[model samples]
Target: MIGTLRTVVLDAPDIKSLAAFYADVAGLDEHYADDEWITLNAADGTRLGFQRAPDHVPPRWPDPAFPQQLHLDLRVPDMAAAVEHAVKLGATRLPGGGETFTVLADPAGHPFCLCQSDGDSTTIADVAIDCASAGPLARFYSELLGLPVTWEGEGGAMISTEGRLPVIFQEIADHRAPRWPDPAHPQQLHLDVEVADVDAAEAAVLALGGVRLSGGGDNWRVYADPVGHPFCLVW
Candidate 1:
């Protein structure tokens, strides 16, 4: 395995405020925080981090110009009540979604889905990503993290990260790849992958079609997957 899914990071203008917003809405506990970054842990063993992005730009969903690189799919017990609570907690419901799921933009303007769930109180079900092709991206992550491609369909695919969290890649007809170092099209969401040997991991991922975006110093380096989603290799 190249690395493990350590944490999903979100770029936000105000790290503390956005971190608190998700913590309040989803009942996640703060794990670590500072002026630049904040990490939170959910009950279902999901971890998310908020990083300070001074000139952060929110994604314009349904628009190829500015795309949401990734989003979280939350499972709520009561759809209506959950929507009401989420709206109250600074989540704005976006227009155009089906009955089974309600699209809501978080305080930072990242579009996330509240799927109908009668199971848990409010759990992060999956991390869904928009991609041009589901199979290739799914395979990339699966092989990188050593996770299994548990589900596959015509237009969608899923990779299970053991019991920590699973990722869903939904096919988008007009998927737009983010151009890093350019604020015009930014990767609103990315991941921090923990690894044992940074050099070995980098070599493996590069061989797996991961593009090296920046130089590695000592602990970490940046890379974009084959589909242009940025993820870090942290040792």
Candidate 2:
């Protein structure tokens, strides 16, 4: 891979509120803040960025029609306590159907889950994508981010490199791609990778089953992976 995965970004109608919600929930520090974007640096060696999307459409969890293209999983010491705290911080609990993990919608309506862990504090566990199949999408991201496929099975696959957050692909029977920049089908989440050169990285990405969708002149460009998930290449 020519670039390193930098951050997983979420589209939000109110950037500041979304950033604050995540920062507080994960106990992360505010690294950067502006009207358009806000970034949080987690103590567990992870970063999250939120961008303002005026016409953003919230996902309808458990409904394939309005799929949550991506979701965040976090490991917390106490699931019940975590849910309560999250609710206090502006998260709305969603019915989980008796699963061990608790699902909740953030202020901007993105669904995220809190899973019980044996730790004292919460930490990001994985950035998960809902895909029609796991292998190809996982492989595409594995190559793009230079992360190794740590686990694979019929249902899903996980890619991880030591000391970094994991990227997971879960096989969903009914998965739909985002129609980004459109309110009918919004991009719930996306990734950002930092590269040395935009042109070289763009070429590498195209060579590795990627397609360019947009560009920001010289500094950055956007592309969709084989599975139709949008990601960015930045210098």
Candidate 3:
């Protein structure tokens, strides 16, 4: 039987940087940090993990030519402040004009969003991504999301933190990178992260094990890990 969503796994050049980024952004303390993986805790029992990838490539977004396969969405108090903060943190503004939402890139070049809402609560609801290696991916996410690796067997890997949200990384050996806007090769899923400060979040991400994939001006920035999975920081 399937359970609730727990943690999201991201591929990166450096797991430490990615974990640090999420840890600071989510306001979660670093539960574990090592060369192989890092994990952060969320209030809702959800966790985020960042795994090391030696050969990583940053993803391109909105271009349609390169296309971002997966990304995350973040909720913020003020859009303008969030955007400004992300830029200082090392995020690149994408071509999208800020309206109801703004698009930004993480250090890995993966796309994520910043949204404005009047809600008083600040919490993370989801974790999403796609990867070729499920075992490694699960382990990576477990550490990043502060989730424990559960159900480790030949079938695949299942992880959960706080015993509520259960994130599963199914084995997909023949996984192919999706091309953006192609429809034929559409992105399967993405992630949304809530952060206090955009710039500080980026810095923390870098400090942990993440790398800035692309950025310039005050628009947006893209970042990546050692493995190439992409995530974004917008300002």
> Each prediction's TM-score against the native?
0.95, 0.95, 0.53
Candidates arranged by lDDT, highest first: 1, 2, 3
lDDT tens readout by residue for model 2, 144-164: 888999999989999998888
lDDT of model 1 at residue 145?
A: 86
Global lDDT of model 2: 0.87
Clashes of 3: 59
Worst 10 residues of 1 by lDDT: 213-222
Residue runs of model 3 more than 4 Å from their true location after superposition: 125-235
Q: State the lDDT of candidate 3 residue by residue for 96-181, as single tens digits.
A: 75677788887666667777757543445334344566677666555444577866777567676564555555444444554322
Per-residue lDDT of candidate 1, residues 90-125 (tens digit) = 989888679889998998999999899878688888
Report the lDDT of model 1 for residue 67.
85
